[model samples]
Target: MWDERVPVHVAGDFYDLDAFRTRPDVLRDFETAEVGDVTGRTLLHLQCHIGTDTLSWAHRGAARVVGLDFSAPAVEAARALAAGLGHGPERAAFVTGDVYDAAQSVPEASYDIVYTGLGALCWLPDIRRWAETAASLVAPGGFLYLAEFHPVTESLDDATGTRIVRDYFARDAQVWDEPGTYADPDAETVHNRSVQWQHTLGDVVSALAATGLHIEFLHEHDVSVFPRFENFEVRGGYHRFPDGHPRIPLIYSLKATKG
Candidate 1:
């Protein structure tokens, strides 16, 4: 499913590949402030789709950046984009492999920063395994950083995003065979089947803590990178509920470090 959507995402206005070529830094303001300076550091991005966010770190002065994704086409596009940005494989590399095997799949054994971007955790069924695997690649003194859509939003009504309509503690995978992609909903596509799991805030934090990664902080924000709810309006490049509406966490970021 992800393989087929790579082209759509690359060409669609959602990503705006052309504009990205000119001004490639797309890291959110809060993410940069939380992650701190990445200059001369090696960063590994897990589940990197099309490598925009991964490359954004590279653009911000990370000495080395590697992006790994399960989709072959996504990796290929990432490599091409890296080359276009004047970065060779040594400076910006991309690999095609499952994130669960990141320790073995990545070129280096570990990295100074292990990053997992938004809308990624929901795709994995075992949050514990993901934490252990991802943490294993965080070099000593390095940290694993995660920016995700808050799980609480999943339980709310899709339209109003106000009332809870689904079980928050549901453990079963949500299976769907929906048509079209998120970038271009009306786009012609075939591989639309997908499965997603829900992991609460505690589930993610506890899983990382179990791996002996000290929790630095967990920050929740009222804004989202995508228009998750019908009532969301654009604010500072993010989607937010109306000013008068009660605010709920739409996104959360975490930083966990090894001793």
Candidate 2:
């Protein structure tokens, strides 16, 4: 799955590797501020593609950081980027493995924080299993933090002007055969077949609750790290609905802790 998307992400300007390297603290302003302090803490990032965000956490004072991805090429590229950025193998490490099978390689309850970023959950088929694995990786009293694109935005059809084309509560597999990638809309690719699953807001909360993780906070916002649907306006670093647009959730963040 990720193997096909790695090149598209790296070469595209959306990730803005140059901007990230020059000013690494960009994302820290809005998304990671709620993560609190990670000084001397062990952090694990699931579906961490290319280690950009993982390295950012390490740069923010994490004692140790590990990034896991399903794509071998992504892992290799991430390691290479880390070495290039002077992170080396000591401060941060990258592993290639499925998010569902992450426990087979990493030990249980070994991390102080389990962090996942935007667009991570839709790639997954089972939210319950993903939450269970995430909960299992955190030590007692540790927390799990996630910032993801809201499912409400997923149901809208942006191509036709914010029409609610899909059901908001649908839990089904949606396949796309587009020729361009999100990162680079102009880049043409042959391996365009992609599979994704949509889970509702209730489904997400229930899945985490089932893992014995206590919900600390669940925040809904109109901002997104990236442009989600077409025709969406980007202002003040957030994506917003058009004038007099109906109320719809765009993004959400959840914080949970192991009891």
Candidate 3:
């Protein structure tokens, strides 16, 4: 499903390829601010679809960067995009592989930063395994940074776009087959079958801690990088709930150190 939606996203208004070509800082403002100073650091991006944010790190002067994704098409496109950025494999590279298998596929404890998640964690089947792999990937003295859509915000109503309809602490994965793509909602109908798990803030924090990664900070913000829900107004450069509506956090960022 992701592979099929790649072209739709690359050519859609959501990604804005033209704007990205000129302004290379494709990551959100908070993400850039939180994961500061990537210069001279070896960074690894997991589930990096199309490598926009991965190459954005390169733009910030990362010494070397590797972006791994399960989609072969996305990885292929990322390689092309990196080439266009005037950086070869030595400085930047994209690999096709499942994020859960990254520990075995890539060199462990070799990256100064292990960056992952941005509407990516829900697709993962197990947060514990994900945390363990992330901990293993981060080199000693390095850290793992995650900026993800807040599960709290998502547990609210989606189908009706009103009221909290789903369980906040549901341990099971929900199956979805929505035809419209988030990037291009009007695109041709495509098979979009997938399973997503519901993970609370505690699940995320506990997983990281169990892997021995000391949590440096966990911050939640009302701003969101994506239009994950309905009834949002763009304010302060983020899609947020309306002015009168009860303001709630839409995104959460975590910084955990590999001690």
Candidate 4:
């Protein structure tokens, strides 16, 4: 899924690689501030599509950063990008593997931070397994920080207009068979196989808690990286309705620490 979208995303203006490089800390002011300083920490980024956020951590003075993704092409691209930036393979590295198998691939209790960036968790089918892998990878007292799209945003019909067509708590898999890419709707594609699962706020919190990771904080933000639903207005950094809009969470960030 990510392999097909990587090139498209890199070429698309949505990622804005130039802007990211010019302003390395694009996510500095966001919810990640709760994670505090990462300098001298060993961080592991899961489902890192092209490793922009992973590279950002390296730029933030992390001692070592490893970006893991299922897409081999994306891993290669991320390594290439890191090398081009003069970081080489020492500061950062990219690996290709499934999130569930990450525990077997990465040493247990080796990382100080297990991080997953925006728009990452929805791709996983099992949140329990995901949480377990994250908890297993984190060293004692280490943290797991996830900044993801709010489950409420997934309930609306983003394809056509701002309409609540799906249940917010629905655990069923929502199949998307669209041909055009999210970045470029007009671009032709060779493969369009994509599957996503919608998880609620409770689902995320409970999953992490079940893994024996204590929750530190969970915050909901009105703003998101993209305007998910049609007819939503972009105000400041948030996408919201004009007024009298339904009260719903648009984005959420969670921080948990291992005991």
Best by lDDT: 1
Distance from true location, Cα of 222 in model 4, Å = 1.1
TM-score of every candidate: 0.99, 0.92, 0.95, 0.91
Residue-level lDDT of model 3, residues 85-155, one tens digit each, is 78899998888888888976664446999998588999988999999888889999999999998888766
Cα RMSD, each candidate: 0.7, 2.0, 1.7, 2.3
What digit string (tens of lDDT, one per residue) describes model 2 on residues 41-124?
999999998888898888888988899998899999888878777886677889889999898865444699999988899999
Residues 95-200, model 1: lDDT tens digits: 9899898888899999999999999999999999999999999999999999999999999998989899999999999999987898999998898899999999
Scored by Cα lDDT, where does model 2 land? Answer: 0.82
How many clashes (backbone N, Cα, C below 3 Å) per candidate? 0, 0, 0, 1
Q: After superposition, how far is residue 109 of candidate 3 from its true place, in Å?
A: 4.4
Model 3: what TM-score? 0.95
Clashes counted in candidate 3 amount to: 0
Which one wins by TM-score: 2 or 3?
3
**Candidate 2, superposed: residue stretches over 4 Å from native:** 26-28, 107-109, 159-163, 242-244
Error of 2 at 224 (Å): 1.8
Candidate 2 — worst ten consecutive residues by lDDT sum?
Answer: 23-32
Give the better candidate number (1 or 2) by lDDT: 1
Stretches of model 3 off by over 4 angstroms after superposition = 107-109, 159-162
lDDT of 4 by residue, 1-259 (tens): 5678788877778777777667655563674577778899999999888888899888888988999898999998888878877777667888888989997665334699999988888888899889888888989989899998888766678753367787877888777777767778876777877889988889989999999999999998766667676667877766675566665677788899988
